[model samples]
Target: MTTTALHHRIDGPDGAPVLVLGPSLGTDLHLFDAQVDALADRYRIVRFDLPGHGQSPSPAGPYTMRGLADDVVALLDRLGMDRVHYAGVSIGGAIGQQVALDHPERVLSLAAMASAARFADPESWPKRAATVREKGPDAMVASRPGTWYVPSFSDTDEARRLLSMLRATTAEGYAGCCEAISGFDVRDRLAEVRVPVLAVAGAEDPATPPQMVRIIADSAAVGRFEVIEDAAHLLNVEQSEQVNGLLAEHLADAVAGSRHG
Candidate 1:
């Protein structure tokens, strides 16, 4: 299976510990702007765009979570990174799970925000993929505002920025990622993850509710779950301060654990 060399940008100190950030489907690397700003001083922040998103090449159809996780490992290999702290949202979060399960030694810790071990109603993802393949990413834009954030955030600049990213996403890229998500299910494999996991959920997230996020925390060998109030699917964007604080603590704890281990 050929892997895509995903487009990426790096921030923070040159030799600091690496922290990789993955964005949700339809969004690009910019989705982690807040996290980069908050953590760049201490960690080498690497943010990558999924296939067909941002400047990444839009390859053909049918991507798998394992394949996507392999692409990430390829990126790490190219960058000469032995291991990293990982965090992701939505499909990105799913990819994080796959990474930890598939390449346990490469991941120091994982923070999955607004994601699930197995997405609910797995069949619906392919249908969404078909819709995007037929009508393009624009077809999904109308419903995203509600599913992505609370009603009060709709008109804000941050909200608009995210929406713009969705509108700009290529149909092939968006649909292929959807196809990857459709077949994703790691509920039974969480027991294999040796690294620490932090599952953050938006209290009001309709897409992947708190219960879904909790499953990852409950199943993993070392896991913790948290819920942010008045947020939805994009909790990191909607509640950046709170999310950032949680991440800071999570990463710090991981570092301390590694030192003591």
Candidate 2:
């Protein structure tokens, strides 16, 4: 599959191990601001925006999971990163899974946060794509508060900033990702992922609940599962300190395991 030139930002010292962070759909790389701030001192953090989400240029519609995964690999190649630890939220997590499944050698570890091995029924995504194309990204804005965070967090300034990202997302870009998600189903292939996997779920997340996230942990060769209370789909943003602690430990363990092996 052809790769898209995804827009990205790099942080941390030159010689540190590379750690790639992927953002959920609608939100840009800034979705990982908290993680970047906490981990950049020890890891070379690379955060990227999906096609047309932030600074990335809008490409044609109907992208695939493999295609999005390829875009990440292309970015890694450009940055001269041979292998790295990866963590992502929602659609970003799906892409991380795809990368692990397709290019295991390039991933040292995987953290799937508020994500799933398979998103909702495949048919629903195309319909969502159609809605976005017809009404623009604004159409999905109303439902995000309920699905993305708890009622309390939804009304905060941080939540408003995230919602603005969805509003600003181009119809074609958002719809294209929706189509990509429609075709994404890696449940059966989870066992093929050899790297260690950390699957996190938000206790209040109605989108990808703990049950859904647990499937990833149960199926992967080396996996762990954890749930954070009082958060929803965008748990990393809502529970930054806890999420950062988990990631720090996961990355450290993976590095140590690699060294011993």
Candidate 3:
């Protein structure tokens, strides 16, 4: 793996087309562990923690999802990649959607997992954002693991590790991202997305449920939705195998289409 001072890590082969992977809020590029392993042989994977989330420097915020989308574009330009297959989970999904919408030529295909075009009500998310900003993600986990994972899924070690990651988020970065999501609304612009899209939602995800995924999928002219069984909001992690399989199948078809074109 190779990385720049900007905190983006470029792994896998040099000649392969890149697959830019973005993680959910508070988490780092580690969110793509399962997908990376599965796709490493066929594609070069580029994964990064957003600024302030992982190794990336935390610039003081009041940030927006569009701003984060710009960061991804910058990363691509820095790598000299004209276009790439983009995949993201949750907030990361919002970022990918913005990038594809704003910079269409830079995106070859889009896969949004467990995300919503518009964020939920501020009243519902405000307290959680405040608690995370002030006390960190741990407080929220104790209070509402349901936002990130299902009840039964939270009993395992993986669940503990994932929750700890959210709890360890830096106040500036986490709060900024929350603020970004608070005002996020991309419903009207979904029709502008001309790229092929794969919208994945967790079957048990209360955050961005299956119906919400359908809304997103339906909005795009060329989009499909898939629900991963027994998974919640953090489907990419909790149901990695199923998610990875779906991703592999979609990516294979995407790559083949690109080659033919």
RMSD for each of the candidates? 0.7, 0.9, 3.1
Worst 10 residues of 3 by lDDT: 1-10
Residue 173, model 1: lDDT of 91
TM-score preference between candidates 2 and 3, better one: 2
Q: How well is each residue in 118-143 modelled by candidate 2, as lDDT tens digits?
A: 99888999899999899999999889
Report lDDT per candidate. Answer: 0.93, 0.93, 0.82
lDDT string for model 3 (133-219, tens) is: 687656656744676778887788878778666766677777777877887888999999987899999888888888887777889
- lDDT: worst 10-residue window of model 2: 1-10
Ranking by lDDT: 1, 2, 3
At residue 98, candidate 1 shows an lDDT of 97
Candidate 3 ranges beyond 4 A from true positions: 1-6
Once model 3 is optimally superposed onto the true structure by TM-score, how far is the C-alpha of residue 245 displaced, in angstroms? 1.0
lDDT of 1 by residue, 141-234 (tens): 8898779999999999999999999988889899889889889999999999989999999998999999999999999999999999999999
